[model samples]
Target: MNISIHSFTLKLRDPFRISYESRNEQEALVIQLSDTNQQGQTVTGLGESTANNYYQVSIERMQKEVALVRERIEEYSLANEVLNAGQVGTPGHLWQQLQPELQHSSFTLCAIDVAAHDLYGKKVGQPLYKLWGLNPADAPTTNYTLGIDSIEVMIRKMQAKPWPIYKIKLGTPEDLAIVRELRKHTNAVFRVDANCAWGVDETIENAQELKKLGVEFIEQPLKADNWDGMKEVYQHSALPLIADESCIVEDDVAKCAGHFHGINIKLTKCGGITPARRMIREAQRHNMKVMIGCMTESTIGISAIAHLSPLLNYVDMDGALLLAEDIATGVTITTDGVHFPDENGTGVQLLTPSPTSLV
Candidate 1:
């Protein structure tokens, strides 16, 4: 068993603006795992923030982690064991044991899961969705995002696209005006993402105002750590609230269960697919809706989530739509919704490595 990593920069097709910031490119770590038996797999892991935010693991640091994990794989013969195990424990229990090794190494854990799924899917000659018992024919329609911009620019952008669903970014009082203007241009179902910009009181006020704009929901309005405040806002506001940052980890779901009407599950934030599935199940049991989302990643990551979108209430897997030039190939995005590959594995095709710069 062996593991290796390469750092790549993905240039966005257009500058992506959010409530927090904007970016022209994204830095990502591509981890490749292989065994002596000729089986090889790859997973692209994105850092927390975009290129300008400095939230990424330094290239040097990432390389070192890859080396360490590669050594561990060899020492434990993990590749052989993972491949040969007739029936592994439930994804949750196996993930629990791997969590210690994964602590402080989110990128590695993400890579490991991707690799494991790729290997497993290949071994069984099935696509990832089938392995998880998900049927692509049941996927829900996905929403495309309209990043923070002047009202005029937003209106123009909306007028040019035929997408039936759109998510607007809002973080300031000025955003109220933008939302109003957007409502006039398109009757598409709308969602607002505050990105934790508002406090409990402000969220309540803004959500009230947004309700008149025909919003379908408001996402992450209050701070992630302020569960009580989120509850206050959720209870007071007429519009539904979806938890984003607040539901990054499994336990975070429990904290926001009673407060949020739904959750935005991102593979990157939750570590990987294993925990993400658990979060979705838990949210379902609590009667909370699910919105599977993604960071600013290539089709590789978005395609991974597209396989599970059918099982959720909402879908926001539009990160690939924002990329300037993606590695290209995987999921297909139409104005109606995202379409997955009919082939085995994730249906993702790894392109020749092309590295860009964050600076």
Candidate 2:
């Protein structure tokens, strides 16, 4: 594994606020795993994990973790090991091989895993979705996120980009007012994400009102750890609930089965696309709605999610759309839907040269 970590900052076009914090920019990290393919062409896989204040995952911490595993990673590249695409266990094998070290941060592991998937796809000369035997036509249209802001600003955001669906962030005394006001503008399908801000009673009440206003679902309304509250809300809430903060890993998929109407799998949070594929299958087995969301990352990360979209009921890969600028080129997501690049391996390429690549 010739691990090359590129660090950058992704600036948001608007200052995005959720329940936990507000930010104008996100610190981003891109992981590229390079190895020679059978044709003697140097191929690299791409993955991204951004700094998150809520999760306390910073670029420095991820870098340190990467440093710890550099030797083992390079050893694989030195052996010229060819990563096989279409095998679900490819990333799992990597996780086990890295062992005690890669476990330090899911963020670091996410970058490496994503890169490995991309590398594998490139090796086999196939896009990931095609390799997985998925049809792009089955993929759902992703919702554009309107982060928490003053009602006026939020409305402007909606006007700027009219989408088929909008995921509104809410965590305020005027939560209803915000949605009510935004609802007046467009007939777009609404999905509210409370970011674990409301209590059980508040969530139930809000769901009733939101359902009336055409809200398709409510996401993470109560705190993540409030399983008891979730149970009550699950029983009584008018709108279907989707778990975000509550569902972090494959195990959480089972836990969220009865509690939430669905589960939202985030690659960055769950250690990238490898486990995410398993999580999606598990959620499907549970008959729960499956969704995959992206952190405020670049096309590299969002494209990773895009390839897996055929398996999801809903998708929130709008993270790259929220950015003022992206660090790379990969997928194109417009109001029409996500369009994959013709290139294989997530189809990602950095705009600038990597001066910080570590051998």
Best by lDDT: 2
Candidate 2's residue-wise lDDT over 148-173, tens digit each?
99999999999999999999999999
lDDT of each: 0.70, 0.86
Task: Report the Cα lDDT for candidate 1.
Answer: 0.70
Name the regions of candidate 1 deviating beyond 4 angstroms: 35-59, 74-86, 89-97, 356-359
Tens digits of per-residue lDDT, candidate 1, 17-84, equal: 88778877887665554433225443222222112242355556555655655555434322223233
The TM-score that candidate 2 achieves is 0.95
Lowest lDDT 10-mer window, candidate 1? 43-52
Cα error, residue 133 of model 2, in Å, equals: 0.5
Question: Model 2 off-target regions past 4 Å?
Answer: 77-89, 354-359
